[model samples]
Target: MGNGDNCNPNWKDASFSYYKYVPSLAAAGIFTGFFFLAFAGHSFRMIKARAWFLIEVLGFAGRAVSANQEPGCWTQPPYLVQTLFILLAPALFAASVYMTLGRIIEVVDGEKYAIIKRRWLTKIFVCGDIVCFLLLGGGGGMLASAKTNKSAFDLGNNIIIGGLVLQLLWFGLFVVITLLFHRRMMLSPTARSYQPDIKWRSYLHALYVASALIIVRNIFRLIEYCQGSNGYLMTTEVFVYCLDALPMFLVVAWFLWKYPGEISGLLRRKELYDGSMHEI
Candidate 1:
């Protein structure tokens, strides 16, 4: 693969190199399988989480297909498919994590302990997640389609960085809120928090683990984009798998092992008990 002309005419004059090496089909396959497993695990219980996992499945599948193509010989469609899907998939994962924290707060009846009201916690964070999603997806599309226009490519990279920075800020705020709630709950536990059936603390711990991994991944990406296409991070295929792929897979696996369905079940039971009390 000599650096002469790209197979796609659109990228013929583009300075950007899509991949430094052939993308690893094995890596893509493994990650895709893990995501599918997570999706199946959550499908019957946590429908919303399952939806996000489904998108991850599609993203890694696209990556696998893109990997099969030789570098510098990629067509426009495959390039866009891989770039856009892989770049945007983590945002969806973040959305699920945000909702999990909201569910945890509800399960513990820790509304007063939380910095943000339980009713608004998911809404605020998920809305921020949506904005990050659009910024990332739109920026990725721009980067992929910029073609021969160097200025356009730079612009796209800048947009992606902006999105990443915003995501980091939101994640930081989320962690602070979770810690504050955890501290308050410990100092003055709610009645529900004492219930043997409610494992809210364990769930909060899981949220911390998940959120930390995401924050690390986002920081890696922010650095990668800031370093530009020819930077070491982009030139090395190993970093993507180790930093982005592995961490994200662990996140899904963690959620599967510590499923949020328990919280949902507890909430349902609480609603039923309250209804019965009202009738009495």
Candidate 2:
């Protein structure tokens, strides 16, 4: 551990230096506000879809508070709170994405075209997400509390990297399943797929955009963690905002612009469709 004079716990006593540069209050505040708008603007019909926005709101709100503290002060609670929340928020975002695809399949009555059975689609991806979430959340907590213990810190970092790898694999498979379903639907279109009001294509496009952004951000994080605390990514502050925060913000914006509630509405209207669909 490094030495410090007056701080409660010497800054050097922390596992890692908290921030290379002071986090920007303005950026954190803007992100928090937008996420709050997303959470509040969603309709009652969109309750399920709106869950992740609340996580983002809390995550960025913690970040906003962390931004006001002295740089490199790892002793504060907000530092750990913001770090863990921000680290884990994307898993929730990906959960909504998984459910959205299942809803989209239902909306188009394209269960037959889906690579995975519609019943299993959300279940499979969400189970994987839950595992990833636990690893990430657990690993983050362990890392945060592992102050001055190099062995504990390395173990936690490895666990986080494992979680990230699992997430990437699951997400990549999800995209493949989505693309295959899209292609099959195009080749043998269902009657519901052609309905003018449903706009399943638009929603699929939005999912593609959101998935791409999340994947890119995850890759950036994977690299950041792999590089370790003293590495270039950790020493630089801009990458966090540029790669992680900005991508997530755009994801929320894209979904807000192309809301997924239509899928839920259509599914509600044709409740029988989900149960009775024939599999090929």
Candidate 3:
């Protein structure tokens, strides 16, 4: 293809160009399947209410991929709507991660094994998540609505960065908590005894992978937005697919493969928590 061909909006033979977008489309399709699995699992009461929320958010994220594709082709209104949903969806997933981790910590013996109180796990992290979501959504909406207003776009991106930073900080703290809990579990027989079953540990490991993937994606987003809309990262497809889309696809896919509903059921049946355990 010539330089002019690169700038062409339409072409008779563009089959090769379509291959570049397969990753995004594949991610969308995979998550669509994951959504159905989540629904089926939840409908049969195999998964808990918390897991249902995770599945619903994955559906939104999967839809965002479709919305995000060919942004240049979308009209102003459609583009704005897409931007809002795409930015908002992942933040919600990060929030759901907090909820997932909270539930896992409860199973792990929150007060005894974890560094922090179990009661505050969801409260603090999820509330922080809400604040981050509002900032990102509000800022994204402002930028999308601003059209050609450069200053407003910059302000909006800055707001998004602020939200991303907060999320990073929260994830960092949670990582520390996870490490401490793991260490305690290894050292204390009581904490290890509270461990549900092998499958439950695998479920927790899946969550750890999910959390790490989301955190990495958030960091990339933070850097991308910090560079502004005109930056290379914003204009590139590879970065978006590798840094953002791939991580999310893996997170949901991993969870679906591990089948959290079954694992949680096993944990419940194992009776890891006596009646005296504090409710999260």
lDDT on C-alpha atoms for all candidate structures: 0.81, 0.82, 0.63
Q: Against the true structure, what is each candidate's TM-score?
A: 0.90, 0.88, 0.73
**lDDT by residue (tens digit), candidate 1, 46-156:** 554333444667777877877777656765676677677767777887787788888888877778888788889999999999999999988999898886688989999
Distance from true location, Cα of 228 in model 1, Å:
0.5
**Pairs with backbone N, CA or C atoms under 3 Å apart (clashes), candidate 2:** none
Candidate 2 on 115-157: residue-level lDDT in tens?
A: 7898999999999999999999988988888766889889999
- Model 1 pairs in collision: none
Better of 2 and 3 by lDDT: 2
Task: State candidate 2's TM-score.
Answer: 0.88
Please estimate how well model 1 matches the true structure, expressed as its whole-model Cα lDDT: 0.81
Winner on TM-score (1 vs 3)? 1
Root-mean-square deviation (CA) per prediction: 3.1, 4.1, 7.0
Which regions of candidate 3 deviate over 4 angstroms? Answer: 1-50, 53-73, 191-200, 261-280
lDDT of 1 at 247: 84
Relative to the true structure, candidate 1 has a C-alpha RMSD (angstroms) of 3.1
Candidates ranked by TM-score: 1, 2, 3
